[model samples]
Target chain A: MPAQSSPPRTDSRPGGRSARVRAAVHQAVKELLTDEAGDALTIPVIAARAGVHATTVYRRWGSVGELLADVATSRFSGDVVVPDTGSLREDLERYAYDLAKDLSDPDTLALVRAIVGTGGEGAGVCRMERQRQLEAIIEREQGRGNQVPTIERAIEALLAPLYYRAVFTDQALSPEWARTLVSHLLPR
Target chain B: MPAQSSPPRTDSRPGGRSARVRAAVHQAVKELLTDEAGDALTIPVIAARAGVHATTVYRRWGSVGELLADVATSRFSGDVVVPDTGSLREDLERYAYDLAKDLSDPDTLALVRAIVGTGGEGAGVCRMERQRQLEAIIEREQGRGNQVPTIERAIEALLAPLYYRAVFTDQALSPEWARTLVSHLLPR
Candidate 1:
C-alpha cells in the first residue's frame, strides 16, 4: 500500500491544500503551453504533468476549455496591471502599452489563441470573467473622474487591437501601437 | 463511372473550368462550416462535398487552412465593400457598420476562427491577404484626399475591435458601435 496524506480537506483556508492543488494545475498548464504550442491539452495529460490525480483535476476542470480559461485568467492578471497614471488618457495609454508589450510574447499569444478560439460553454464562462476584469479597470478610471468610453467600447477599441496583432496577424506588437490606440481614443 | 469532363484546363478564363472548380470548393467549405462547426475537414471529405477530384483540391489548396483562407478571402470581398460615401467619417462609419453586421453571421465567424486558430504558416497567409484587402480600401480613401490614419492604424483602431467583439465576446455587434469606433477615430 502507498502512504498518502489525509484525504483533501474540504474546508481548507486560502493557503491550504486546495490552493496548492490549483497552483499545481496552473503550473502544469503553463508548462504544457510553453513546451508545446498548438498541442491538444487533455485533463489527464495535465494531471500527469502536475503529479496530481486525474480524478482531482477532472473534478475541478471538466474540459480543456475550462482549464485553458482558468490559466488565462490567472496569467492575464499577473502579467497586466491596471494603469493608474492619474489622468485617464495617460492611464489608458500606459496600460495599453504594457498590455501590448506583454501580449507580444509568443506564450501569451498562444494562451490568448486558446481562449479566443476555444468555442464552447467553457469559453463563454472565460469571456465573462475576462470581460469583468477589463471592466473593473475601466471603472476604476471612471471613478477617478476621467472620462472614458463604455467598458465594452474600451475593450473593443483598446484591447482588441493588441490581441489582433498578437494572435490573428503576423505583426509586431510595439508599445507605439498601444499608444496609437490611446491617441485614437483620446485624441490629444 | 459517370461521364467526366476532359482534364481541367490549366489556362481557363474567369468563367471557365478553373473558376468552376474554385467555386465548387469554396461552396463546399461554406456548407461544411455551416453544417458542422467543429468537424475535422479533410481533403477527401471536402472533395467529396465539392464533387471535385481529391488530387485537384490538393494541388490547389495543400491544407485545410489554405482552403479555409481562400473561402474567407472570397467571402470577405463580397460581404464588405469600401464605403465610398462622400465624407471620410461617414464612409468609415458605414464601412465599420457593414463589417460588424457581416461578421455577426455564425458561418463567417466560424471561418474567421478557423483561420485565426489554424496555428503557424496558414494563419500568416490568411492574415496577409486580409490586411492587403483592408489596405486596398484604405488606400482608395487616402487617394481621395481624406486625411486618414495610416493603413496600419486604421486596422488597429477600426478593424481589430470589430473582430475582437465578434469572436472574443458574447456582446452584440451593432451599427451604433461602429459609429462609436468612427467617432473615436474621426471625431466630428
Candidate 2:
C-alpha cells in the first residue's frame, strides 16, 4: 500500500474544490484502512475522518462499493515489487512469507476484501498486476533453463493458501504455512 | 450443499415456537441464496419470504453476517458427494469438473461470499467438512498403493481457485480451468 499524500488546503474553497475533497476522502480511507482499528467503513465515519460533510461523500460516491472501486484503482495499479532471490523457489518462498505477514494485518485483509467486494476495476487491476508479476518471474526462470511450476500451479501454491486461510478460516496466516506451501510446490 | 427440506407448516404457530421460527428463517435463507437472481439479502426481504416478523429476524440474526454464519452452518455441515473412480487422479478430475459447474452458479457464489464475509463458525465448518472428505479420498488412494497430494495441497489445487476467481475476478470458472488444476496436481 502507498502512503497518503497531504494536499494543500489553500486551494480548498468549499464550492469548487472537488479535487481537495477527493484527496481528503481518499486520505481518510487510506489512513483508516491502514489502522483497521476503527469502526466500520460507513460513509459517516469516513466523512467525519476526512473533515468533509457526509452529503459531499454521498453525492460524490453514492455507495461504499463505488468508493472502494476508486480506491483499489488508484492504489493497486501494479504488483508490489518482488524480491529477486537467486532461485525461483527461494523467490517464491520469500514472496509467500511477506504476503503471509501482509495478510495477517487487519487493514490489509479489509482492503483486500473491500477490493474483492467491489468486483470492479479494482479487482481487475489486482488480478492483472499479479499475473504480470508472475509472468516476469517465470520469464527469468526460463532464461536460467530451470524447471518451473506453471503460472496456474504457482498461483495455487503461492497465493491461494494465504487468501483461503485469511478469508475462510480463523487460523493464523503464519510463516510456517508459507514455508509449507512453497515446499509443496517444489517438493525437493 | 444440502437439498432444501420442506418442513410441515403445522408447527408454525407464530408464538412460543423458537424451533419453528429458526427453521423458517433457515429455510428462507436457503431459498433466497439458491436464487441470488432475486434481490439482496436483507432482514426485511428474508423475513417476508420466511413468513416470520422482520423484528424476529433482526432480533435473532442481528445482521447479514450473523445470518450467513447460521446458514452456512446449517447448509454445509458435510462435503457435497464426490464422484468415484478407480484412479485418484481421475476421481479428482471428475470432482473438480463437478465443482466447477457448482461454483459457476450465481447462488453458490453468493453463498460463498456470505460465508467468507461472516468469517465465523460457518467458515470453520466449511473447512473441516472438506478436510474430512479429502481424508476419506486419500485413505482410499493409499489403500491402492497410490500417492496423493496432501490435504493442504489438494485444497490449494482443487478448492482455492474456485474461491479465488469467484471472490477476486470476473473470470468464469470453466471446466477447462478445472481440468488444468487437476492436471497440474497429477500431471501425466
Candidate 2, residue A69: lDDT: 70
Q: Pick the candidate with the highest lDDT.
A: 2
lDDT (10s digit) by residue, model 2, range A106-180: 766666665554334555654566566766787789889988878877877777767777777677888887888
Candidate with the greatest TM-score versus the true structure: 2
Candidate 2 docks at the CAPRI level of acceptable
Clash count list over all predictions: 0, 0
lDDT of 1 at A174: 81
DockQ of 1: 0.38
TM-score of chain A in every predicted structure: 0.74, 0.73
Return the top candidate by DockQ.
1
How do the residues B83-113 of candidate 1 rate in per-residue lDDT, one tens digit apiece? 6776677777777887788779898786776
lDDT (0 to 1) per candidate: 0.71, 0.72
After superposing candidate 2, which stretches have Cα over 4 Å from the reference? A1-9, A12-20, A23-55, A73-79, A118-121, A143-148, B1-52, B77-79, B143-146
What CAPRI-style quality would you assign to candidate 1? acceptable
Worst 10 residues of 2 chain B by lDDT: B113-122
**Per-residue alpha-carbon lDDT of candidate 1 for residues A108-135, written as tens digits (9 for 90 to 100):** 7766665554554444543454456567
